[model samples]
Target: MEAKQFQLAEELRKSIRGIVKTDEPMAKHTTFGIGGPADLYIEPADTDDLAQIIVWLNERQIPWFVLGDGANVLVADKGIRGAVIHMGKPFRKVKIDGEKVIVGSAAKLDKVVSATVDAGLAGLESTAGIPGTIGGAIVMNAGTYRGQIGDVTEKVCVVTTDGVQLEMTPENLQFRYRWSVFQEDKNKIIVEAYLGLKPGNKEELVRTMEYIRHRRNMNLPTVGRSAGCMFKNPDGYSAGQLIDEAGLKGTSIGDAVVADKHANFILNIGKASATEVKELAERVRGTIKGKFDIDLEYEVRIIGDW
Candidate 1:
């Protein structure tokens, strides 16, 4: 069955101008640099090309997953079974129109922050130094000390599994702690976003972003392969502090370890497997739960078959 799927994927690859691969390693694309191969990986040339591919795949009843910069995802050891569409250069276009910024889903969060600040816009300054694209940020409601992506997002364009486009508003998005309506809906894929930001002094914005960068560098493990914060901060409590208090810091399972710099972050100590990371995360969660009676929920997206 796997061989037959690969053959079909090859045939489909020839139909599109975008790059496509069969049995593409998930590790190569993810921030953690781990996981097994994906059955089919496709990079659409542009929005139109993506739409066409989505339609074709929908018609054939083929399953597909949309990939951003892979900053906060954990692909399984057995790997993904169907198509994985990775939006590249074509989807990374960023445009600033007055106080409103129009950005593609594949546009990096850092790029958006820089562009907005350069344009004298203020809302996105706090998002500086965050990895991954705008789409992933919006879906996860990515935020820090300043504010969340939800605060700036005025509108979002998503492509549904049925090949239908949806223009969703903030109220309709159901944004919450480390989640959004997009995260709840498996079939929806964020394609672009319209951000409404307030005007601000350019120098002040630059200084703010610089301060954020300094704080992030001091607190997080930026050198290693990591998927940012491993667990969401439970209400009124930081996940890192809890893990540290439980004495789980610097804990290791194979090559995956709880980062010494930040106990909430699980770093891939080179050649780490997704299974190892998951196991370590579970152990941390168990320890924290046992010690504090507080369950630590995963902030990173864990996908694919076990």
Candidate 2:
């Protein structure tokens, strides 16, 4: 099986005209900087290139996972088998047409928000500090402050598992609380999104973005290797507050430590392994659960082997 997988990776390298890598460190690509290498990593050139790669992999029964900017994920220590597709430049395009914005899935949320704000668009201002791409934001229905990505999204273009293109409206997406229909159906890959926004004062929009940035800087640890928020804030309560109450702040397992400033953020002090981070997270969870009788749900997506 190992030999066959290697042969398949070689075939993929020859067939796809995009970047292909073997034994690529997942830590380098992730926000946490703490994961084992992936067996195969490919960054597709465009939607057509991506579709072709997917079709080839599917035909051969080769497993694959799509990754965005790695802002909201935790790859395992044992690494991953098969292919990992990281969408790149070709899908990072963003354009504004009057009150509507057409954003490629690979386009960063920060860039999208900034572009819309600069164009006097109002609806996305509250999402200014959010990281990752449009596709990830849409997949998770990413929200902050008082607004969510689903609120402004008009339609989404996705590629079905069978390599068929699908254009779905907001109603079809069925978004709610950091989840979407795409979360339940793993056979869809977001390609692009159409957002409906309204005109607002450009200066005001800029001010709003600045304010959000300031707030994030003060509340979250913007420095170091950490995947933003580790746990989702439970209903009517904050995860950080609960973790802090459990006395888990500054807790450490190897180089991984709960942020002294923010209990919900697990920071990599230096050269932390995926194992260390996972252990620290579990310890924090156990402590919180023991004290509060509430299981803290992880906001960061954990993937890869083990």
Candidate 3:
């Protein structure tokens, strides 16, 4: 490590109450089982500590990236520079207040769904079986055909890059199909969110959640190392269906293969490199475009130093 980088890591360790590691392997954190090492990996103790850490990094002009459950991203083989911040256990609390649900950003989506169902709150059933953290769900506006997180989100507590905390309303969030303001602004970090839900029968909510889970299992690739859906649905068509119709399923480049079960998913069958997966994805896109003249957009984020 350079003198400047070493100095920054040592100073950060003393200043914040969080877990800090240098040259941490990114493969251990992501679901795809890929990626190289991160220069600095941090897990903030709490919202206050997270805010402090962000401020310090900003002041130093050091770049950082936030990692949630690591469900929808592809990290490069060259790894990430600077820092990677994870919310950790401290940010996994869920509080139920009558018809409102206050959940920390690091909380898992399925756990929050279960909590709401148990409390007779009916809003998050559509997100059952979805992978990743609440913060990731909010950033991506995660959803199914039934509903989205944006539908019940009233507001969220966020820390700006300047160390200022603010509660932003839904209007400020600007949630659309798989898009949010957070996606555009890397400096704005979510702490927690308030969801307003309606009272419903617990039994009915449970049934709905179960049904959603069943549907997802039936269609999604279940037995592989993957980063969820590879491509977003086109305006009037499903990306999976298009790939399926194009007979691109089971296509392979190195160890990266198009999932047989779900054409939209690209599976890391073995020791697939990031470059291999990206090349396979590009090939799929080219084939689809040539056949149908429709371009496919990636839903999975490709990140790191490439």
What order do candidates take by lDDT, descending? Answer: 3, 1, 2
- Report the C-alpha lDDT of model 3 over 49-130, residue by residue, as the tens digit: 9989999998888799999989988999988998999887999999999999999999999999999998889989999999
lDDT comparison, 1 vs 3, better candidate? 3
Worst ten in a row by lDDT for model 2: 1-10
Assess each prediction's global lDDT (C-alpha) against the native. 0.88, 0.87, 0.91
Give candidate 2 misplaced runs (Cα > 4 Å).
Answer: 1-3
Per-candidate clashes come to 0, 0, 0
Q: Which candidate is the best by lDDT?
A: 3
lDDT by residue for model 2 over 93-192, one digit each (tens)?
Answer: 8999999999999999988999999999999988888889999899888988578999999999988768888899978999887878987787788989
Best by TM-score: 3
TM-score for each model: 0.96, 0.96, 0.97
C-alpha RMSD of candidate 2: 1.4
> For candidate 1, lDDT tens digit of each residue in 141-209?
998856889988999998877667889999999877778987778788888899999999999999999
Flag clash pairs in model 2.
Answer: none
